[model samples]
Target chain A: MSLSIFLITLAFIILLQAAIPFLLKRSIAFGVTIPEQHMKERALSSYKRFYSATILITGTLALTVYLLWAKNRTLSEDQVVFAGLAIQFGVLFLSMIMYLYFHVKTTKLKRTHKWGAGLKQVRIADLASHAKDEMLPSYMFALPALITAGLLVYTASQYSQLPAMIPTHWDIAGQPDAFSRKTPFSTISLLLILLVIQGMMFGINVMTKRSGIKLTSAKKKASQIQQLAFRKYSSWFLFLTTVLITILFGFIQLVIIQGGMGNAAFMAAMPLGFLLIMLIVTAIYAFRVGQGGSRIKVTVEDEEAMETAFVDDDQYWKAGIFYVNKNDPSIFVEKRFGVGWSINFGNPIGYIFLLVSILLIVLISFFS
Target chain B: MLIQIETSSDIPIYTQLSNQLIELIARGQLKGGDVLPSVRSLASDLGVNMHTVNKSYHELESKGIIRIVPKSGAVINPSIRDGISDEHRLRIVEELKPIIAEAIVLGMTAKEIQHLASSILSDMKEE
Candidate 1:
């Protein structure tokens, strides 16, 4: 396969990634979850219009760029790949901007009507008594780490068998494109990557756990249960991902030494497999439980206690997304209407953490 | 030691915290010398402002229900009647006056009012 083939696949992957978030956002229309039931239709219509317009503009821009690039046969494969990637990414960036814009509008509309405005913050009595239940799922990452270690030993056992130059990069059609020296680092780089990914996922899991839940007074118990469920579900998701990555990378390592780079058909399918798994899981949970998993109907259906349940407290959210509450000391809190956790921008520690995280990411990028 | 507070209640958050702490203390759920959580930690747990938690702690301290040892955590004070000054007695009566008046206005019979307070006591015991 040529560079063009890889580029095409990458563009498609990016497009799908963008669409998944949009799909979750679309669930608000069903009133099965989010911003309470009454105001959902309004949000739905406004968001639908916003999304449609953004998609139209983004598609046109991408298609124009692709056609323009198609007509120019002088461009090298690298240029074609670069052009395709840029077009897809540009579309994503534009759509995100539009998404935030509409989010701000919806937030303002929610505020105007005073939706969920009367719900009080629920406080836990004897905070220390029940705090032990919020245990970190660190063991989840450990499982993958242990698997990687086992694989590392297996790879090292074949140290004498690996070729002088091992295949490092593959083409879309499963052909080796770039080669690297068969040193421990080169042969084991895939494992190292897996380890780094595991660490990042674990860190995120811990951070999300620390991010406190947001719930109203009447629904405090139900909300707490939901938050715990969501956390449990997320950790399991992380663990599953680690196991999958371990198997994939472990297989890749074995294939490189055992069957040769040309035999690595799995390499081409790995990305597609990962994306499919992630999309399927996300779709199932997001639809079933909704954002923060707060609207989950399973145990949260206590009728008498749900009078104050969860209100769409989107008013305090700056731009209808970033929660800004000076009174809240938590650095992180579950997002009001999104699937993931959001930082409490109102807290100084949150800004510091965000800055540090960005710096760490930059350093990692440079070192890697 | 469960202390639940409602933020939107007309009652202040600190009052809610203090009232629940008092209830726990009275019910023996919080025994003498039982250490309460630090202001910062409690605030973080409940997602409330530090001052709000501090206020609650201070309120408990002022009532002689808890002792805030310097550099140490707040501890429940032994509920000994060291001697009730007339002013303290008056204050207690003043606190109870509103409840009695509200119950009377609601047309609750004296026996029913007693039953209501007893039900609350019984419920607190269950927790």
Candidate 2:
């Protein structure tokens, strides 16, 4: 089971890397903005093909080598896990390098060709979109917190019957590898961490609601519909993931509280199931909705009027990845190269958010 | 309602924003009591400086087209039926004076100007 999981994870990573080009907004290719008319250029298609083929070939070769090592049984289970991680990171690094290569090549090509020179450059905002009842209500997230609280109460009531030492670490086989003296803190720590994570999830939902909707001028009405749909579906995805994570953590807490009495395979399967569900759901969401709802289908009546070029602000995007615009007050903007939003590094609020998240992770780790 | 900003336009960003918003209001697309997006929200949505959107909101408020409530947001004011005040009428004439002069210099007839104004008015009411 572990071997299969490792192989499946590696395959997923490689495919996802190759699929990155497809997942980006149609206006953006390899982190560079392309005019609608230039998107179908032969050179661009060849570049995309070369990038994907290179990543696939290199990643598959590495995975095959790892498979051979794993099958030889010369390496321990821990080494097998580490080797799988190394391979995944190796592929990821290769893909990043290739992406930058294409980004530079595309930028150079666009510069020489003047892809959108003649078109009017414009940005659009929909005032009424904010008023739309699109987001999942904040109160809905409170359900998971309520469940955690219930578990906390149960833990308190059963404190006397709990083991003196509780498992704090588990191995691949679900055997307890480390333990800490049972105290009220250790007993309820996981529940507390779960609560904090759930709160963060709630915060993310609120941020999504307030994040600016960037409409593509190439298809104003269609882009508007797509943005709304993107916001709606992404928020729902977040809420559902929050619920699933809360349940997974709750199960772990229950097992720890009960002195690790659950079956070994079941215990191991819980987290694996959580990861599998999350990956599958995210892949499906990205495929269906796309970055900024670029994949969503919509029709507009006056296509000619909306044919303005998407404003070329490539200067703001450093390497087609990090967005650093001092003049742009937006805290979050849709990423140019990938799915979902990225922080505007020029905004001080982005740094504050990053620091707070790091602090939360530290707190969770310290307590655990 | 959608408000578009042309970065390369000769008009400043804030003026463009205020102009488009006023046009929306004049067309009744943004009705009385409708709350405009907050400065930060609109600025971020248009990817411009917050001061730009703030300037536009203040311009609208100065023109009495909207009232900015500190907490809630900028709300469109109900249209008043009373004819323009003398000062306001004079200000309108001062603003239109240059455009009318230019039209005349460009060989546009007075009747053609009247027809243009009426056509624009009808176009607004059409929607």
Candidate 3:
């Protein structure tokens, strides 16, 4: 059952990867910014087909190997899982290689054509676009935080009831594989970690709400609607993830406090169920609202001058993926290729936040 | 209001920003007490330097079209509250002097210039 679940997860990931060419902003192809009219070029469509075929074939081969290896009775479950993970990572690495190859080809084509040259490169911004209004209310995040805090307080009150050796780690079969002496801090440590992670999600929510909305210049009103809808859906998705994670951790905490006495299959299934829900939500949101809301339909007349295209600031995007602009004060911008935001590499604050997050994770792991 | 800046235009980006904003206000799309986005947000959205947005905001403030409160950002001032001052009148003539001179040099009659101005005025007033 676990293997089947893993296979399904892997298939979903591969499907998403193969759909990238169709999922990206209409102006962007293979990480290269192109004129809107050039999107229908024969060469571009052929490249997309080749990319998808390569990814699908590679993914199928890797899954087959994983299934064959797992069915062998000699290996333990942990070893089988590790091998599956390694195969998954290998597939991901190859997909990156495929993407880079096509990225280079598209960039070359764009250069040879001089797509946006000698045009009035313009950017449109709606002065009335309110960041705070585009997001879910801040109070919605408080429920999970409140639950975590309540759990922490309850665990403290029942500290004496916990077993001397508290279960700190559970394996794939949901058996307690690791334990730590039940000090007051160790008893409530998982709750603390949960709170910290919830806080991080809240921080990201704040960042998304604060970031400026970037609109396509051709149809200002239509683009504004799309941008706002994208923000709204993404914010809701983030909130759902946070709440789901909080509930899972809360469940785990309750089982731990009860001396890790739970049904083995159910315990193992909890996380798998969470993963499935998250994947389904992500697929729905991505398809409904493509990267930068490119999939959303909003009609405006094509009355803007043909020469006036969106500002061709492609020079700042490294390989059309990494955005490094020294002048942009924004720390978070919508990703050029993906569903959500990417950090501005030129901003020192991005590095600072990243380092802090890593340190926090390490510290939490150490304490627990 | 959609504010667009043409990077290849002869006019400076800051001037274009301010002019578009003024046009929006004239069209009644932005009214008194309307707040503009902050300089950092606007600049990043437009992919321009923050200083450019700041310059444009200051230009609006100088013309008494908006008030830049330190923490709250720029807000449009009530246009009916203040009559045109002599300083503003003089500055307008100074700015348009070269344009009118070019029109005359190009052999435009006084009546034709008046006709052009009235047509533009009517266009702006249209809903």
Candidate 4:
């Protein structure tokens, strides 16, 4: 792959990734699970249709902007990649503003609808004893650890062949932008990142498996099944990301070793493409399934529950967004208006975690 | 065991929690030595205040339905199976007094009230 090809591919991959959560929001009816009777109504409703249309329109505009930007044949390959990335981010920002406005409006609209009213009383359900055991093979958790160890060993064994000075960093166009002596500290940053990410993923999986799941009820069995499926999907997401990280790191190691057999660009493309394709696929899956298996079909349990008993928790939901119920000791809860989870700002520990996490991210970005 | 807390009930949250937990023990859904979820966990699960759950746990401990060990979470007491005392009998009667009065006010026959009590007991027994 040439530099131009890589840049365009990377741009599209990122735009797609950024667009996914919004796309998935359309499939979901205000971030709640799809009840069988409400399935068509939810899908066909103006909220979903408008959101879907907006996503399509935003995506088309983003691509057109990229194509038009790419027309600047006078620009260097590096400039092209940089410009493409900037455009994606700009387009994504606009799309996000549109989503936030419409998403809040849609959520409020849902409150007046029967399906929304009936799906209230959102409570967490305990994980069935078998859920964790059944979701994925236990061995899958060890894959990242094993791969990391293997890569470390392999890199160490090739140290003799590695040049005294190695390229520590590369620009977006597969060209070396920074160099350092062939030391573990210089070349092993990616490995460290991978390990940290793996640890985080492990923590997440354990938490999900042990913690109670949020359910829109009257369908206990189906909801439990859906929770389990979501857990399974989460595992796959972790596995794929781990694989991508390993490839990119391994690619770096190869560049440091044999200089990629004189096909640097081509060698980089394989792993980069693999990573991008995985991201695109994951985004598509998220779009179709929504968060926490919202769109997965199962037999709707006929048993009726107090579905109409909507908890008037708006006060607890601080600023109508961040959940700040000091009484709720849970560290995490399903996000009220989006796919995935949010940390409870109520629990003292949870509050601390949120603050520390934000601080760490900011500090890292600034220093890096 | 499945335990439910009615969020919309007029009764106080702690009182409702204690009552439901006691009922669970009565029906054998929660057995002797069966550990309940930690106070924090249950409060989080029910989306209620932790102090409310703490109060409920204390109430159960006072009644001898569940024990709150220093480090361990609440556990149902084996002594829950022990027969009631004269005090307990008096307490039960005292608790039922208002309802009995209401039944009388509503013009329900004594036989009908007796049947209602019997039906509830039978349902609990089946569980």
Best-performing candidate as measured by TM-score: 2
Q: Show the colliding residue pairs in model 4.
A: none
Reference contacts reproduced by model 1: 0.65
Reference contact recovery of candidate 3: 0.76
Clashes in predicted model 1: 1
Which residue pairs in model 1 clash with each other?
A125-B3
lDDT of model 1 at residue A335?
58
Per-residue C-alpha lDDT of model 4 across residues A1-368, encoded as one tens digit per residue: 33455455645544453444444423244444333455566434665556556656766666666666667566776676676666656665665665567556655555556444444344433422243434455456667777777777877787677777777566555667766666665555555555665655555555444334544445556656665676567666666776676766666666666754636576456666875677576665666555566667778664665545433455566433477767666666655554455666766665564465456545543333
lDDT of 2 by residue, A1-368 (tens): 56778888888889878877877676788888888888888888888899989999998899898888799877777788888888888998999999999898999899899889888779889897677738798888888899999999999999999998978778877777888888898888888878878887776676667778877787777777888888889888989899998989898888887775777888888888887998899888888988888888777654565555677778899988999988777777786776776888888776676578668767866876
Better of 2 and 3 by DockQ: 2
Instruction: Please tell me what DockQ candidate 3 reaches.
Output: 0.72
Ranking by DockQ: 2, 3, 1, 4
Task: Report the Cα lDDT for residue A342, model 4.
Answer: 65
Question: Could you report the DockQ of all the candidates, in the order they appear?
Answer: 0.43, 0.83, 0.72, 0.35
Ranking by TM-score: 2, 3, 4, 1
Which of candidates 2 and 3 reaches a greater TM-score?
A: 2
- By lDDT: ranked, best first: 2, 3, 1, 4
Query: Candidate 2 falls in which docking quality class?
Result: high
TM-score between predicted and true chain B, model 2: 0.96
lDDT of 2 by residue, B9-81 (tens): 8999999999999999889898999899999889878889999999999999998889999899999998878
Tell me the tens digit of each residue's lDDT in model 1 across B6-103: 76579988888888888877777788988887786677567778899899898888777899999878999887767876876888999999989998
User: Which digits, one per residue and each the tens of the lDDT, describe model 3 over residues A297-348?
Assistant: 8776556645447667788899888999887777778888778888888877
